[model samples]
Target: MQQTKEQYNTGTATAKQPSHEADQSKTQRLRDKKVGDLMVNKRRLVEVPYTATLAHTMNALVANKVLAVPVAAPPGQWIGAGGSMIVEADKQTGTVRKHYIGLATMLDILAHIAGTEDQLMDEGVNDGFDLDQKMSVPVSTIIGQCLEGLSLWTLNPNTSIVDCMEVFSKGIHRALVPVDSHMDNVAGVELVESASSYRMLTQMDVLKFLKEHASSGSELDGILSRTVSDLGVVTERVFAITDRTKVIDAIKCMRIALLNAVPIVRSSDADNEEDHKQLVNGFGREVIGTFSATDLRGCHFATLKTWLPMSALDYTETVFANPLLASIASNTAGPTSRELVVCQSDTPLGQVIDKVVTKQVHRVWVVDQQGLLKGLISLTDIIRVTRFAIVAEPNP
Candidate 1:
């Protein structure tokens, strides 16, 4: 398969900008820089041709973690008398054509082919639609219908990050193509991954980390009691035990109550003066097996002890005695893969997203130090919350 120009560059560079230049104030920097200053190098672009398949396009987008591509014209050829001349051949004879196409942006192509915003929401299949079927829409149709006159802006190799942000804040476009004739037919394309209009801060990343690592903090004082504890306005109820109790029973309770998650606590002991509950420095509290609606599609639940069969498998006695039955037996005999990832109730939200993103976890349980389940947060929840905040915030 032919690769897009974007796939060619590894993005590693030895040349470093001076420290003084890098530390300029945001306002001062933006005023001094141009698009060419902030623009990524030509080799950094993610390029695709107009004729590439939608499946190919989508895969490239996902692999590169980018949303756009640059389309370019075929390269010119060298003539005996002239340096490099456009190859022109007779159309009827299938001769080489000297003319090359200039660069185009991914947003333009997506706008045309991805269906209108309305069409995508109403019919184009963005919300859990079949990816294969959706890929059939032609790029030409999309570009022709939606993004008229969308052209790739060329940027000098030395663009500054601030200037790139300014271009994004203007809400004009999301990609820049670099022109380098020596490279090949189509030079390359760069994805403006972030729009300057959006506020991005280091604090956001910090908060996200804290949320996911909330489980690592010291548990609240005297928070390990079997009974629910109230901290002024807040209260935590202990509903399940993970030690003596099997995961089967815990899952059963989760289903019956229609609860998103349940808190697992150590059973109370009378002999000890320092209560196990009191020893609760927040640790060992895990969200374990969220039953939220979002998880229904991804979990392998048939092995749970609480899993009452909605129906039974019918098979010949010989078939049941065969190797397939052994496979089922092995699976049924093992432990459930469900695990709990709990965070302190006070941890910031962004921290949670970062931790979970790296761990391949679907949800994080928020809890008090006593190992009690407070509430559950999912990745989807964060995204939905963030998007809402952006949309609802008053314009400055």
Candidate 2:
């Protein structure tokens, strides 16, 4: 039977399992589902052409409420001699390509805009470009000039759902599955052309699939038994900012780190009276709140325009001085600041998923017994495990 969103959310399709054996059988069925079954086919997918401007890309993402979109070669553009296809060629060169070259994400756009702000200030009026004109810069220029070194990860269509989950668990937001293609012999040279197929898999898709298939408690248990630490995918380095950090500086840190969100922490001395002079930071610091990409969405270009002229410290003071500005500051944590969704490093993966889905939040902080920050678990992280389970061979 086909699964529907309503059936999943309402748990109408999940049956009460009478025994552990029956629960295992149901989980096996879920593992058998293929990634192709859940993927959004290319024809129905939204994409941006290689030649689109940054403005056009931003409009598409905002209008669709999507975080990113696949960037494809212009229609009918052919690459390689005799129509042999190349995935991505330098945009400056008039080389035609047949496949998707990269992905343009909201984060990428934000970083580009942030980077441009520095250039505008450094060059002053001599830069010869005003605020409105800079905003109109072509996406091609930004991708080529600003993000020349980045690459997008691609996946195969036949990849098992379990394997896909592993990928998402790595904190990656999306993956592109290229259309099936074949090599053709033209005059003794191999040329490639599309079977005209592809799809995009995202965290949202994984969440939907989990909601549909793992609705029952027993079914959820089968998947959630695996601990997050067991995945061995936590980032090696954690970056955070103090609670008093300037909002603009925090944005710059995220842009540099290429992170959608960052943990907000505060440093304090340990309670041990004998070690009064010692300062405990890093994993020992307290996590006060979380600042995320969503917060930046509330900031207008006008806010950026007004704040660009000031120093970082001045920017912080100005934002704090005005209640209206404080509310819109990208790093202030705003209204929901105190309601951070957090878990321990040893917390079960299922609990994390439950909190994230039920709370409708993107990430959960991994804290220690003392409530000090340890790590993070985002939807992308949990989704990875689900994708991996679908692809992994079951034990005999």
Predicted structure with the largest lDDT when compared to the true one = 2
Candidate 1 Cα outliers beyond 4 Å, as residue runs = 1-30, 34-43, 73-134, 144-151, 157-166, 177-396
- The sequence of per-residue lDDT tens digits that candidate 2 reaches over residues 1-396 is 125533322233335555554445445455545565666432455777778877778777655555666666664552322233435333455344545555676666666655636554443333343555556776555552223113445555566666666766665566555444232121111123344444566766677567656645433555576667776534424677665554555556666666677776763444333221121234657777665655444334546566544433344333445554344432333334355688876666777766766655677778877878877776766775665554463544
Cα error, candidate 2, residue 322 (Å):
16
lDDT of 1 by residue, 194-233 (tens): 1111111111222232232223111211221111112111
Which model scores highest in TM-score? 2
Candidate 2 lDDT at 315 equals 44
RMSD, candidate 2, Å = 8.5
Number of backbone collisions per candidate: 31, 13
**Candidate 1, residue 44: how far the Cα is off, in Å:** 2.8
